[model samples]
Target: MIQRLLFAGLLSGLVVALFAFSFARVYAEPTIERAISLEEGGAHKHAAVEKGTISRSTQRNAGLFTGVAAYCTALGGFLAIGMAFLHGRLSVRPRSAVWTLALTGYVALVLVPQLKYPASPPGVGSAETIGVRTELYFVMILASAVCMAASVWIAFRIRRRMGMALSLAIATGLLVALAAVLMTIMPAVSETPRDFPRGLLFEFRLHAALMQLIVWGGLGFLFGRVAEHVVEHDRPAGVVRHRIPNA
Candidate 1:
C-alpha cells in the first residue's frame, strides 16, 4: 500500500510540477523579472538587491523545476499519509475522500493564510523580514490545519447527537469564525508599495492562486483514481480496510 501510494504521489507530483512550471514561466516569471528590474533601479532605487552567485538562467529553468518538484513531492507524500489515516475514519467514499482532502488541504494551507497574507509581487517585502514572514506564514498554515482538524473532530463527535448534516454545519461555521478571528488578530504585513500597479499585483496573485488550484486539484483527482484502482486490485475483498504496509 505504501509503495502504491508512493508511486501514485510521485506520478501526481510530476504532473503538477509541469503545470506549475508552465504557470510560473508564463505569468509569475514576468512579474518577478519586473521586481528584479525594480530592485536594479527601475522603480525602487533604494531596494537594490545584491547579485547572487546563481545565474538567472538557472533560476528560471533548472531552479524552478527543482523547487516545484521537491515541493509537490513532499506534498504528495503528506497527502498519502493523510489518506492512510482517513481511510476508515470517515463515511466518505474512497474517491470522495481524495476530493475532500484535496479541497481541505488547499483551503487550510493556502486559501486561509492567503487571506491573511496575500502573495506579493517581487521586491514587495524586506530582506530582513524574510525569516519573520516565512515563520508567520508557516504558523498560519499550522493554525489553519489545526482548526480544520478540530472542526472534523467536532463534527464527528456531535454526529451521533446532532446528526451528520447539523454537526458538519456547526463545525464548519465554528471553523470559519475561528479562522476569521485569527486572521484579524495576526499582525498584518503590508509590504507592497502604495504606488505599485494594482492591476499587476492582482494578476500576479490571481495566477499564483490558479497555479495552486491546479496542483491541489490535480493531486486530489489523480490520487483518488489511483487509490480506487489499488483498492480494486490489491485488496482481497474490494473494500478499503486501512491496511498499512508492514505496520
Candidate 2:
C-alpha cells in the first residue's frame, strides 16, 4: 500500500507536468507590428501596448519545473511517512496523526506563497493566459485536504479511528466545496471584479465545490487500505495463560 500510494503520488507529479507544458506561453508573440501597420493612430495603439504587458507576464511563468516539483515533493513526503509506518519505526498512531498535519501544512505552504505577490491578484487573466491564479491553485490545494481526510477515515476504521474520521470528513468536505465554488466564481468575478455581487452565494467557487466529492471518494479507498494494515499491526498479542486443572 505504501509503495502504491507513493507511486500514485509520483504519477500525480507527472500529471502536473502535463499541465505545466500546456500552460507554456513563453514565445506566443503578438502581431504588434501588424496592428501598428494597419492603425498608426486611435486607441488601438494604446490597447496593443497594454496587451503586450499582459503577454510579457504570461511568458515569464510558462515553465513546467515548478508544478512537477511541488507535486512530487508532497507525494514523496506522504510516502516517506507511510514507509516509516510500514517498517514499524513509526507508530500507526503517529503515522495517522502526521498525515493530517502533512496535508494541511502542504496546502498552506504551496498556496500562501502564490498569494504573496501583487501582480498575481485574482481575476486578472484570460483562460489561455498562464500564471498561478489564486482560484486555480485553490483547486489543486484540495488534493492534500482530500488525502488527509481519507487518512482520518483510516484512523476511524481501527479501534479508535471513528472520531478522527468524522472530523476530517466534515473539514475536508467543507474545503473541497469552498475550493470548487471559488473556481467558478473566480473566473467570472476576475473578469469583472468591479461588478461582482456580494451575496450569500459568494462564499464558494463552483469548480472547487464539485471537486471535493471526487477527492473524498478517491481518498476513501486509499485510507481504508492503510487503516486495515495499521489495525492488523495494532492487534492485541495472543495470551498463553495456563488454565487451572481439576483434581
Candidate 3:
C-alpha cells in the first residue's frame, strides 16, 4: 500500500513539474532576470560565462526544471505518507482528505511563514544577515505548523460536545490569535534596498506566490484523483464479495 502511494506521489510530482516549469518560465523567469540585472548593475554580463560558472540561461531553463522536479518529488513523497496516516482518520472521502491536507499544508508551511518573512530576490538583502533570516523563517514555519496541528486536535476533541461548527470556530479563533501573537513577537526583517524598484519587488513576490499556488493546487488535484482510484481498487474483499442468499 505504501509503495503504491509512493508511486502515485512520484507520478503526480512529475506531472506537476510540467505545469510548474512552464509557469515559472513564463511568469517568474522575467522577474528573476530583471532582479539579476539590477543586482549586476548592467555589468558582468559575460563574467560568469567566462569564468566557467553556469550561465543565467542554463539556470533558468534546465536548472529550473531540475530544481522544481526535485522539490515536487520530495513533496509528493511526504504527501503520500501524510495520506497514509490520514486516510481513514478524516472520515472524509479519499479525494477530500488529500485536498484538505494539501490546503492545510500550504497555509501552515508557505502562507504563514511567508507573511512573516516574504521571499526576497537575489541581492535584496545583506549576505551577512542571511543566516539569521533563514533561522527566523524556519522558526516561523515550525510555529505555524504547531498552531495548525493544535487547532485541528482541539476541533476534533470538542466537535462531539460543542458541535462541529462551533468547535471549528473556536479552533479557528485560537489559530488566528496564536498567529497574530507570533507575528507581533518575531523580529521584523526589511532587507530591500531603499533604491530598489517597488514595482519590481511587488511583481516578483506576486509571481513567487502564484508559483507556490500552482505547485500545491496542482499536487492536490492530481493526487486526489490517484487516491480515489487506489481506495476503490483496494476495498476489502469481504466488502465487495456477494453473500449467498441464505442458502
Model 1 TM-score is 0.90
lDDT of 1: 0.81
Rank by TM-score, highest first.
1, 3, 2
Which candidate has the highest lDDT of all? 3
Of 1 and 2, the candidate ranking higher by TM-score: 1
Q: List clashing residue pairs in candidate 3.
A: none
For candidate 1, write residues 1-247 as lDDT tens digits: 7678767877777878888888888878888787677667657543437789999889988998899888887787777777777766676666787788888889899999999988886767777788899999999999999999899888878888888779879998998998998898888988776666678788889888998988898888878888778646776875646533211
Cα RMSD, model 1: 4.0
lDDT of all predictions, in order shown?
A: 0.81, 0.40, 0.84
Q: Estimate each model's TM-score.
A: 0.90, 0.30, 0.90
* Candidate 3, superposed: residue stretches over 4 Å from native: 42-52, 237-247
- In terms of lDDT, the poorest run of 10 residues in model 2 is 25-34
Predicted candidate 2 versus true structure: per-residue lDDT over 1-247, tens digit per residue: 4555455544444443444333332211122222233333432222222334444334435423454356544554454455446443333443353344344544443432223221212222334444445555555445434544554444445423345446457656655555455444543323323322332113222222222222322233344345445545555678432422211
Candidate 3: how many backbone clashes? Answer: 0
Better of 1 and 3 by TM-score: 1
Best by TM-score: 1
